[model samples]
Target: MGDSNATMVTEFILVGMSNYPRAQMVMFVVFLIFYMATLFGNTLLIVLIILTPVLHTPMYFFLCNLSFLDMFYTTCSIPQLLVNCFFRRPTISYTRCLTEMYVGLFLGITECFLLAVMAYDRFAAICNPLRYNVIMSWKVCFQLAAMSWAGAFVLTLIPSQFQPTQFCGHNIINHFTCEIQALLKLACSDTRKMEMVLMINSVIDLAVPFSFILVTYGRIGQAVLRMHSAKGRGKAFSTCGSHLVVVSIFYGSAISMYLRPQGKTFSDHDKFVSLFYGVVTPMLNPLIYSLRNKDVKGAFWRLLGKKMSE
Candidate 1:
């Protein structure tokens, strides 16, 4: 009987922005533009890094990974969101909904680990310049990137296995996507254990990385002050400052959504918060890095000039 009840919900209706009928078309246009820009920016960055030998350093390698992650992250949910914006009643099958939830979870956790790895890279570069190359060699970079993906896989897979597999008759998801919090609200089974799992995952995936980044920057700050060369300090600050901004934007919105008290009813505020991280942050990442970093700008112009000359 319990299993039968769980199997009852075959599809879910996504409320999305349907509540604001006047804004649906406007939202659709805005999101479409954001989505296009995200793909173009991240994709261009990835190609630029690969083609420019100067960008073959460990920092850009990690950046390449981040670019790819951002592209995938936005692709996972935004297209569905755009399509749903056209309909008054948008629906998704159970299988796809769960798939989206798990995939988003995996990518998000991977990013948490990846960001910490990037911080360590920055720390090593600033604090141990002589050994920077040795410390962040291609082999080490590969290993760190691999470990991030693997760790996120284990973390997402294990906790997800313990979550409820069945939802009660209610199938309306208030948010645009099958966000875990919204999905959990529909579950017929007791979700206390599931919420506990989410809380633990949040600490490991959100709080830990954020704290590590803060500490890493603190050490970098100390190293910068010790430097006698203003030029060198300026360079370090330039690089680290861009990364810190990215970290603040990504982690701030994410922590607010995931680390908050569990079991509270999901609200409009929560949806917008998720939007900031999921849609806004990814769109902003490549722009932030490329605009702030001289290397990226030079590489882009160089590539363009070469093509034109040919």
Candidate 2:
């Protein structure tokens, strides 16, 4: 909130399981493969959402934004992680760390809310089919997407505005990047406010989005059960199934990571939980929706077959 900038720290050292020698090399290769897949998988989703007119609906519109955010989200952390993991020396400056955190948090938080919006879109489409177009129109979709990004920036960027606490005790962060939790751990200040901010953010992030997703699915399940024909019910379920599955993975990891940060006797698990959303979710998103959805499959095949002939 201050016009003057906070004093920047020089660099960050990523302490990624330094005790495990051979494991560090192994992790580097594994994460490399994940990064490659994350790039291609998410890029394809963006293209599919754009190139296919059938996919120009509000659902796909939001999905393209998700892919875009996921692309940056994974990119912000993974490549730098590779340097630390493989090269054995990973350091990031304070300004760079805050920037990464800003971008990473915004993208991650935006995706969380965007998923909620997508759930609502699916909800209106299935539960109240009579006004799907009217309810989830282009204008509304654009507004929702903008709101997601804006909300994330306003909420996260505010906390990051403060100067980083001195890490004189231990300058090493155990994880890959300078995430809020890891950064806070390095802080030598009275971080009660920072912790409170994170707590409040967690509540809003989990409660609002989780509630929306659940209610959407609940209405969707209700509508599906009321179907007269088995085929009709299957059809309805199929339409929402891919999205529901995606929402589950995306939200589940996110909620699990952000919700109960204190109950754990250990914090090492944060790395794995970050992987689910930061890496797996991005890579799996296109695959999940494309492989599972019939129309998307048809579009993929049609696009592929046409490309091969050309």
Model 1 agreement with the true structure over 1-310: per-residue lDDT tens digits: 3655665788899997787778999999999999999999999999999999999999999999999998999999999999998889899999999999999999999989999999999999999999998999899999999999999999998877777766757899999898999998888788888888999999999999999999999999999999999999999998998899989989999999889785556799889989988999889989999998999999999999999999
The local distance difference test score of model 2 is 0.78
lDDT of 2 by residue, 242-262 (tens): 878888888888788777755
Off by over 4 Å in 1: 3-7
Model 1 TM? 0.97
Q: How close is candidate 2 to the true structure, as a TM-score?
A: 0.91
What's the lDDT for residue 112 in model 2? Answer: 80
Which portions of model 2 show Cα errors greater than 4 Å?
Answer: 1-9, 261-266
TM-score list, all predictions: 0.97, 0.91
